[model samples]
Target chain A: MSETLTIFTYDWVPKGPRGFVRDLRLRWAAEEAGLAYEIGAVPFEDRQPSHFAHQPFGQVPFLTEGDISIFESGACLLHLAKKSEILMPRTPRGEAETTEWVIAALNSIEMVSVPWWFLGLSGDHENGLSGWLDSRLAHVETVLGGREWLVEGRFTVADLLMADVLRIPQVRARGDRPASEAYIRRALARPAFEKARADQMAHFAAADAKRGEG
Target chain B: MSETLTIFTYDWVPKGPRGFVRDLRLRWAAEEAGLAYEIGAVPFEDRQPSHFAHQPFGQVPFLTEGDISIFESGACLLHLAKKSEILMPRTPRGEAETTEWVIAALNSIEMVSVPWWFLGLSGDHENGLSGWLDSRLAHVETVLGGREWLVEGRFTVADLLMADVLRIPQVRARGDRPASEAYIRRALARPAFEKARADQMAHFAAADAKRGEG
Candidate 1:
């Protein structure tokens, strides 16, 4: 039998980031493709050198399959997408569209929203990136309004990632973008996303329970 | 004969952003892959609906090859990388490493640095993202210090994207990271990068002359 894919994430995170942790992205992709995977954990409070070796930024959600280990949730999603036509279509155009939207979510939208959200964390709700973030979101809204899926008129890793970026609470609450909202809603309604979120929540909850027991 | 790949960019840009436009990334990649390509232009002063259709963010550097249209410089690089082993190795492990680092350069490093640079544009030399940017850069420095190339100890599209992100003046000036400095220097020394930058500069300079004539 082929070795099960292993996803690495923090053993525990503060309540604020429990469900939103990026390991859920890898897990969601795996579930969508019906691929079995196991979760591995590194310490959240004290990152080891080994963790940095796996993820240079010491971030989580790196994946290991057989001898190959990959970092960056976006990259991991692409790797998983390659394994199943269910995650990404096999055709050249379909793959190209999926890849483009995946990069768009990472480089275009999250590039603005993540920093904007970070600035807002210090209680400055409308920070320097507000206008830029709003403009990006508006563009995404325009695109979403015109299409049901980001690629090939079906659910793919592109939708998986774009939806994840849109689902960030701070980003979602920023404005009323009905099409983007509907897109996110439709993506989250998938059983794979549901399983991924629940599994991630339970993993962290178990860690909390273990701490209490000790 | 196959149609040459076409890259789309703005007809003209201000002097400040002349060399830094992202079409350079696609140009550099094509040059490295030894692929024949042509440059096309959209009006810089007035972005048309068609431009937005090709690039949802209305940004430039989308590529068209035959019937396939791909946007996002990162995605374009990947698309081009597939064409030549000179840009990316065909082996699964090499490709995985290259893809991860490519996404890392885009989603990880640029995600922090670009916003940090943008926030600094209004003369706030050190903005809210300064510490985050520094920490991220320091991590990159550590990675670069130990390796000559981002993947497989050879120059790949990962190095191309990472070097491009690091070359931004604001990000480059942030600190004295010798390893990263050397990496950037090494990458810029490539003839492909030189040709891409020169071609891009001349493309815009011609536009300047045209406007003067009109």
Candidate 2:
């Protein structure tokens, strides 16, 4: 229990990705579970070999605790979910349902939305992935319409991850699903999410100030 | 222990997707783990309310075991992993590493390869996602060049899924990564993968005969 849980992310990033850095996923999970943790930083401008040693893709938000190291936000979230029942239910059926939704958010939703967002960056809003992304969003909207929480009828890491994936500004603006909109509002309104978002913003703001002073 | 693990897939499919359906993932895992399981099928053409009840998206390859029902191939793989160490490592560090690579395959590699392939189907072989997909594949190629296996110096479910994702003919033909090619060949060389693929093909072929009879 004395071992520290460290969420690793870039030391600083620009304005665009401030609150949305994936480390927020880890921070939010920790906050929800009341797990003591700290933020560790890798240089945003110059990723070190040690950084890639942790995350093969040079992506942010890898995690290390004790002797265990893990990357991929979805994987890291599952790792944290193992530590606390607050993040996941202990029953086999509950765990299975939770895991399915977690993967659905990562493999199903983010898989399309992230690339679609990237293609749209070229100023072509209705790119090749537009129709596919809409279909995925519609499916999720229907699911969210009927469920207050993703699994076990309560807040779990699945909801945390799903809400994060759906809340991306571009993705949120792409369609008007009242249920999904209300779901995002409900999830973001959580005290744990608020604290995680504030902490991430402050972390970046501090980096900005240091760069200015330099 | 008496619970039967059933992998639910579409009863039939066109030749185009015969060997590539995601249910092969579960079948392959079951074969690898030597777990006793059965295949259950839903009508491919007339997806019923029951099918959607299991898979909100009406996708094939949902799984049910006793009282637990789970969907998402990645989720089913993890569920199977929990039932047998042969599918995953038992140690904490080893398990963490395996899980990270599993998510990497699903969220990182397939996420790009699948959408890229979808867009390419439109005849625009070089689409907006081309550069990004290339960047991802190149990074993976570099990683594969340095290691024979993704985790624990042995074939784990991570390798099974990664190899499955990489072995798509289009993805393999898209680039010249000798290491990735070797890795894919090595994984598919396993009897478990071979049997799973053959069984999937046979299942669809029987469905074809029944359709002809009707």
For each candidate, what TM-score against the reference?
0.98, 0.97
- What is the i-RMS of every prediction? 0.5, 0.8
Model 2's CAPRI class?
high
**Among all candidates shown, the one with the greatest DockQ:** 1
After superposition, which runs of candidate 2 have C-alpha atoms over 4 Å from their true positions? none
- Local error of candidate 1 at A102, Å? 0.4
Worst 10 residues of 1 chain A by lDDT: A1-10
Candidate 2, residues B1-214, lDDT tens digits: the string is: 4489899999998889889999999999999999999999998899999998999988989999989999999999999999899989899988899889999999989889898998999887688878878888898998999999999889999999999999888889887899999999999999999999999999998988988932
Angstrom error at residue A158, model 1: 0.6
Give every collision pair in model 1: none
Task: For candidate 2, give fnat to 2 decimals.
Answer: 0.78
lDDT of 1 by residue, B1-214 (tens): 3467999999999888988999999999988888998999988889999988789888898988877899999999999998999999999889989999999999999999999989989999688999999999999999999999999889999999999999998889988999999999999999999999999999989998988932
Q: What DockQ does each candidate score versus the true complex, computed on alpha carbons?
A: 0.90, 0.83
